[model samples]
Target: MIASSWLLVAFPALGALILLVGGRRTDAWGHLLGCATVIASFGYAVAMFVSSSLAEATDVALYSWIPVDALQVEFGLRIDPLSMTFVLLITGVGALIHVYSIGYMADDAGRRRFFGYLNLFVASMLVLVLGNSFVTLYLGWEGVGLASYLLIGWYTGRPSAATAAKKAFLMNRVGDVGLALAIFLMFSEIGSTSYAAVFAGIGDLSPAVITAIALLLLLGACGKSGQFPLQAWLPDAMEGPTPVSALIHAATMVTAGVYLVARAAPIYNLTETGRLLVTIVGAFTLLLGAIIGCAYDDIKKVLAYSTVSQIGYMMLAVGLGPFGYALGIMHLLTHGFFKAGLFLGAGSVMHGMNDEVDMRKFGGLYKRMPITFATFGLGYLALIGFPFLSGFYSKDAIIEAAFGSEGWQGWVFGGAAMLGAGITGFYMTRLVLMTFFGKERWRELKSADGREFHPHESPPVMTVPMIVLAVGSVGAGFFFALGDRLVEFLAPSVGALSEAEHTALPHALIPWLTVGLSLFGALVAWLIFGRRDVPVERPQNVSPVTRAARNDLYGNALNEALVATPGLWTTRFAVYLDNKGVDGAVNGLAAALGGSSGRLRRLQTGFVRSYALSMLGGSFLIVAALLMVRFS
Candidate 1:
């Protein structure tokens, strides 16, 4: 199975091709087929992971992918600890999402086509994590981007969905440029893109070149992962179907950036500058997402921003280099379970409540939809680092790792991570309280869809997956963090963990401090939202801070001001130059020639009298010149 790991990608890719090509013919059972493909992939991944040697990487070369003069790249699979870990996550979580979508999307007219896109999404992500070379990874990278565009725009009739799809695609391209450049630099500097070769040859290059490569890779990571400025597209992506949000936010697209950074551990390990910049982006975006999440009435968008914030934690972890690489991957795994469950729970809520997403309108759901409430609540606990939950172990480890950093680096990054935890608790608690624990606001009136708000649980298909993920959310972190097993598992790929030589704070005290802050934040949320009768209508008048949080801290407006407006002016200027500089020169010369030729053309007017007069004048001039010469 390890030797034939290519089958993992093939199953889903083949399923996508069949479903897409079969078209309407597959409508009867296309979703089941999609689920089977991913489930098969997951089973195979589990087998390969269990069978394969964990100490060293295994290369399964398929064929020569690129055979240029100095560039010999093989299409191959790297069945290693790191890649296989992602493989299991993608296929396992992906398969569950597929099953959940069956119930989630059953009534939609485009269910068959949706299944096809889902298969494509799983296949592309498999290729991304399993690839042995940079070119192969890039192929998967672009495929994921394209598949996302298709999935996000599945509701083509909706103008908002189309706009969101375009936004995601275009914004991701900015980061793609960085990834492409990094690959080009790799090939130019090291003469190969194979992981083994690049890692081996990287040290031969200068520090400047290595740092450039690392930072460039980080830029691409930010794009795919929704860090910082690239973070805006993520929440807007919730305009797509809820299943798409769960898949993209939890198990697939957004996680790609964290995978990219973790995979490039060798490059990042050499450059403090690269790692420092990465940490800065992560710490800031974590807070930014948390802040924005607090003001959203929409449940899905709240989770979307939470995805942004959580990915920020992963980024912060991986940015710590050897000190936190395995910790990052651990958190990512645990986050996959809880976050995916949370999103699906949101979907279930929508399913029950006539497709409404506003938490302002959702209240006392726990009694109505016990299954969804139980699952979402557990997932929420995991997300907010509730004791004994998955997030508790993984997130606490990261905070401790942050505090281990020396000097101001420790406090700044540690402080950011700690503060982010508190904000995360506050906002997430606000979401849960408004959604499941408040007054029965939905009983007051009809929902947005003009239906009476009769909330119920999702069907067995969807609820089962939520339960499974919720289970993982509760316990996966303990298993992964136990004895540093995942760290040991990932050591061969990301390098062994290296503890900071010194610490700015007591290591044992850090977890206590983190839990204290998280609980305090939760307490504050209870005081503000839980103890009050929530209004159904959002308030117009608010404080500046509240307003700013509601507006995503003016991120979109800032983007318009800094990027869109300047880009628009630059484009207009280019058009103006093209019209005046290039076209004007060419057109002016053409006009000059046309004018000169018009005057000359006048002299050639066809007439017998004109020809005769010209001949007579010539004869007279010749005679006059001869006479004058003879006289002289």
Candidate 2:
């Protein structure tokens, strides 16, 4: 079964090929085929997980991909506990998203193309996780970037969608450069890009080299996972269809960063500076996401920011070195369940509300869409770390681990995690209240077409998946955390927790402190939103802080000032140089030659007498010059 692991990626790759090349011939049942492919992959993943021996990692080499003197790279798959975990999450959640898209895109003329892109995304992400070497993983990394661009711009008719796609592609490329450089360094120093070889030789590398490699990998991770400085593209990605949001932002694409860090634990463990940087990045990004999440009116954008924050937690967990690698991944799995459900539930809301996304305009929808409300409510609870929920088990563990660190690092990271939890509760509770609990703002206001608003439940095709994911959101943590099974399963890949001397926080206080802050956040949100009326019209007069958050805390501004403006100016300068310097030099020389040739053309007068006279004059001048020289 491990030897045939290539089938996992092949299933969806074939689906994409058929749906795309078959064209209109596949439109009738293309979506169903897409769903089937992912489900089949999920089934295979489950079978492999149950039957494969967990004690040893299996490497399946499909072929030698690149061979040169002293350099060999194989197209292979690594079947281990870590890769298997991601395989199940990707295919399982992906299958659900595919099913949800059937109803979500049923009316669109390009639904077949959409399904094809979804399959391509699944195949690409599978390759990223299963690849046994960095080179192979980079192949999948580029594939995912391409697939995301296509999916995000699915409605190419919308300028915003097209722009969003371009932004995501370009930003991801920036991080990709770091990953590429890191691989080059590996080959330069270690003479191979294969994971086995690289890990085996990691000890021979200097601390400086290891730190450089770790940081480069983190750069790539930040770009994919929507961490600080590269996070602006994520919320705008909401311009894509909600199903795309559910699949990419919630379950698979964004989590790739966490997977990258966890997979590179051998490198991270070697340098304290590298590990501390990861912690700092994670700590900063989680707060950044949580703060921004509080100011969004768009339901999907809110969830998008929430995703940024949740992934930050994962980053923070894995950044804790051995203590948090398994914990981070554990949260990632649980997050996949609830976050995907939340995004799908948002889709269901948009489906019934005539595709409205503003939470300000949504109110009293519980009665109209009970299934969506129930499923979304469960996911919301899980996201907020409600007692015994999946997040409760996973998120709280991370918080406890943060505090378990020795000194000020623990205090700082633990504080950030705690504050982020509270802000998460506040913003998510705000979303729930505005969208479902208040008076129907729809009844008072008209839609874009000036028609009265009508809300209803989505078809069973969509709601059923939401319900299924909701169950996972409620139960997956308990299952994974019961015996620390997730930790034990991942120990082989990440190594067991270290017994290094550190000042550990009191374990009893962490969970209570986290939950108490969360409740306080929820209370504040209810007081501000639930007790008061939410205005349907966008509020103009607001505090400066709210305005800043609405503007993404000047994130885009900073990018524009530091990156976009500089880039634009550099491009303009290059164009100027090309026109005035390069082109000018060529054209100037051509003009001079043309002008001189034109004057010289007079010497070629068609008149024979004139030509003879010119020749005689030239001969006389030459004779006179020779005579003068001889006389001298």
TM-score of each: 0.96, 0.97
The candidate scoring highest on lDDT is 2
Which candidate tops TM-score? 2
* Model 1 Cα lDDT, one tens digit per residue, 451-531: 888898889999999999999999999999888789889989998765543243256778778888999999999999999
Clashing residue pair totals per candidate (backbone < 3 A): 0, 0
Model 1 residue runs over 4 Å out of place are 447-449, 498-505, 588-604, 615-632
Q: Give the lDDT of residue 184 in candidate 2.
A: 96
Local accuracy of candidate 2 as per-residue lDDT tens digits, 1-632: 88889999999999999999997989999999999999999999999999989676778999998888777998999998999999999999999999999999999999998999999999999999999999999999999999999989888899999999999999998899989999999999999998899999999999999999999999999999999879999888899999999999877889999999999999999988888988998999999999999998999999999999999999999998887899999999999999999999999999999888999999999999999999999999999999999999999889989988778988999999999999999999999999999888988887787766789999999999999999999999999998778888898888876445123434667977899999899999999999989988889898999999999999999999999999999999999999999999999999999999999987886999998898899999999999999999
lDDT of the candidates, in the order given: 0.91, 0.93
Q: Over the full model, what C-alpha lDDT does candidate 2 score relative to the true structure? A: 0.93
TM-score of 2: 0.97
